[model samples]
Target: MLKEAVKKQLHEGTVIPAHPLALTSEKKLDEAGQRALTRYYIDAGVGGIAVGVHTTQFEIRNPEFNLYEKVLKLAIEEMEKGNTPDSFIKIAGICGPVEQALAEAEFSKSIGYDLGLLSMGGLNHLTEDELIDRTEQVAAVIPVFGFYLQPAVGGRIFTFDFWKRFADIPNVQAIKIAPFDRYHSFDVVRAVCHSKRNDEIALYTGNDDNIVNDLLTTYHIRSGDEKIEKKIVGGLLGHWSVWTKKVVEMFANIKDVQGEAQIPSNLLTLGQEITDANAAFFDSSNSFKGSIAGINEVLRRQGLLQGNWCLLEKEKLSPGQAEEIDRVYRSYPHLHDDEFVKANLTKWFDERQ
Candidate 1:
């Protein structure tokens, strides 16, 4: 069970970046670079970090690589070293089949992780009932942060019924809705709002394409005879992995106007600017083939990463992706955290040494 204070922190909302992997040119984990990235996130003032998710590359689970435990250990160590608050969330990504997922959940809990960001990718072979059973088994070991990944990625779609039942689980504390489809996104929200445990489950947006709007709009969902209100309290996003300081500041500004009768026109415009930047960073043009590498490119430019390397050799930036990143960099100087990283990159690295 989550401590009341930790649960309160999640309900109040905060930014939690989907942590990325730092690799050397030899395709080996750069221990120093990995530690530096963790320190960078803490210093950026983010409320939490979600490691081993899609942004961290699923290939890390391969026996050839076997970086799952090492990556999680590295992040928690840095979090401890930084003296983060108890409310600073630690999420370990849990994936694979029922047996593998259960083992990952148990390992994550043993290492002081607070929640397991459960992924349902590569499990289409299982029925929705079977999937729910799998989730229940994992939840028995640790609290769950349900993930609805977009099909454009490796994610498969789940029915609204699946979400309703999933939310009914007592150990499920939150959900990251990122199907990237407005209708499907609504399905998850409506299901959760209709569930008996709605109040206990925090809704976090994984929809990187619509981050600003998701946070600003409140949903008045109709479930049978009653109307229920729900809001996406925060984001656990891959887009946030880059320009984190700016993202943190953006989230704060959004929160300030969340309760206002009329949102400022400037904030709406800023949303498009952010989506435009996401298009470049996430490679929305080429079906996101370069998405992960695109994030690495930004960090590489900021000097946080030695290079943009993925476990899979074919996962490099797609054609014209670099130009798109450059265009956004030129167009939206306000959105980049280059200056923040510049002033602190040396210090972050120095701490690791």
Candidate 2:
């Protein structure tokens, strides 16, 4: 039923889309670049996209909202483009302020997005009532896909009660779960997915580090383990899924039952590799800023991303670090060549016998 639901969404413009690893302007989308980005996903067989329209000082006090306006116009243009299947999957994204997000949400609906969500970044901890009120405001406008990420990555995380409140909104179809504490991913996925009042609300993982494991494991069990082994969450949205085409392909292939018997090895290998990579780039290994920079570089080298576009990552790459990234990932080769991507992808899903 869950697989069918996901497939239905995929067929209905439900692309398990990727998000920005970094919001910095080191590289970014221009008119040509945005179209190129849309094409990149279509080529990769991805269904849709979620562009981040960022804003600063959203503390609800300084009072300058609508900061993400230009970004929204760009993303909305892509969303609005009337096109074919290879052209249109789905477009999910975030706008800065609640009011602006509401307008953007309505626009996304008007433009035919499968799902629309608001970024919880710079969001102050609203009271349960306030959260519900705001959520209903958006839910009434569009299919409210909740961006329920913890604020570990320079954003604010909400409380369980806050989620319970938000989920109560009728159109709250899903939540993007990227918790600061890894275990919170498990916890929130459980709490949100199993809510009697929120059964319709799905949990999608945004933590790239946990993508394979997240998509492969079961998290429905609260206290015990009947072992819901078929996986619950839909997919990664942030760093993991952005340029990791091979990983997504591996995932798409893994969804096939005939491929299930062979999934464990590749799943483990891929999960571990991604986890280690993210850790080195995101967690203890370096600053979150550096990780996004590294990921963008990886995407550029792989040719899935445009070199002209860059996020304004707070961390700067060292003199040789950029070259070193190319040199290091060359051994893997999947990062660059499509033939190599296909080869590794085949090994992961087909040759595992």
Candidate 3:
């Protein structure tokens, strides 16, 4: 059985940022910086966070085996100190080969994480049937958060039938839909509606390009003899990491009127604005050379990061990428929470110091 406490926490209106890694000059985990980042998110009042995921440069897996354990342990420790452990769901990304993913899931459970954000990296080569078998194996060890990551990153598009079968797995709590394409996006919603486990699996939009639109949509599906409607509850996103406090406030406002008679017209307008901002920050114009660095640059400006650094030196922001970010940063003043960061940066950075 799934933990009732966790299940209750896993509903609509939950905003979970795929937490980024804070790196030091020597290219190791910056413990205090990472801790400060965690505290910042908790204070922002996000429902949860996913650590050691793509935003955190899962590349750390190649050189630093023990860092993931350290980060998880420290996050748990800090959360306990905050006295709001039950207020958030702590999810760890478990990717790579099936064996490695299983081992990471096992570790996340031992450290008190609520669920495993499961991704099939190497298994992308497997047939759909074979992939389903592997997914079952991981879900058996711990509750799984299915991932429909976008192809722009390391993600590949899967068949709609793949999602329908995956949803039938009892341990799957939620799926992060980051296809970034509307056609493929609907494919996920369609599959969930057809599944026997429709009510069991929650859908979170990781579609940075369509965040507000995804949240505003109401999905209608036939559950046996009855018709049911669902909304993309919230998001687990890399875009969320930079202007987080603003994202939280926006979520609260959207949730307040999500099922009401008519959503405010401004919300639709905001959707277009958010997509426009994402195009620049995500480097869509330049084919995404500095996606992670772009987020770091925002934090750098807000004094949250030492500099816009990544684990790999080659990952630096391209000239066009930086110019695009500057344009968006100037264009969309309303979308950022820079004032919030400014007010709290002193105390938060001191905690790290």
**Best by the lDDT measure:** 1
Q: Compare candidates 2 and 3 on TM-score and give the better one.
A: 3
Deviation in Å, model 3, residue 323 alpha carbon = 1.9
Alpha-carbon shift of residue 262 in model 1 (angstroms): 0.6
Tens digit per residue, CA lDDT, model 1, 1-353: 88777788899999999999999999999988889999999999999999999999999999999999999999999999898998999999999999999999999999989999999998889999999999999999999999999998889888999999999998999999999889999999999998999999999999989989999999998878989989999999999999999999999999999967899988899989999999998899889889999999999999999998899998999899999999999999999889899999888898534
- List residue ranges in candidate 2 displaced over 4 A: 1-7, 10-15, 19-29, 53-89, 197-199, 222-230, 240-244, 257-263, 280-284, 302-315, 318-324, 335-353
Once model 3 is optimally superposed onto the true structure by TM-score, how far is the C-alpha of residue 273 displaced, in angstroms? Answer: 1.4
Clashes found in each candidate (C-alpha, N, C closer than 3 A): 0, 13, 0
> Each model's TM-score?
0.99, 0.73, 0.95
Clashing pairs in 1: none
How high is the CA lDDT of each candidate model?
0.93, 0.52, 0.82
The residue-by-residue lDDT of candidate 2 on 293-323, one tens digit each, is 5655655554444551333324445445565
Q: State, as a TM-score between 0 and 1, how close model 1 is to the true structure.
A: 0.99
Instruction: Evaluate model 2: give its TM-score.
Output: 0.73
On TM-score, the leading prediction is 1
Across 51-150, the per-residue lDDT of candidate 3 in tens digits comes to 8788877676775445777877878776666666564788888887778888888998888888888876546677888778878988988899988877
Cα RMSD for candidates in order: 0.9, 7.5, 1.8
Order candidates by TM-score, high to low. 1, 3, 2
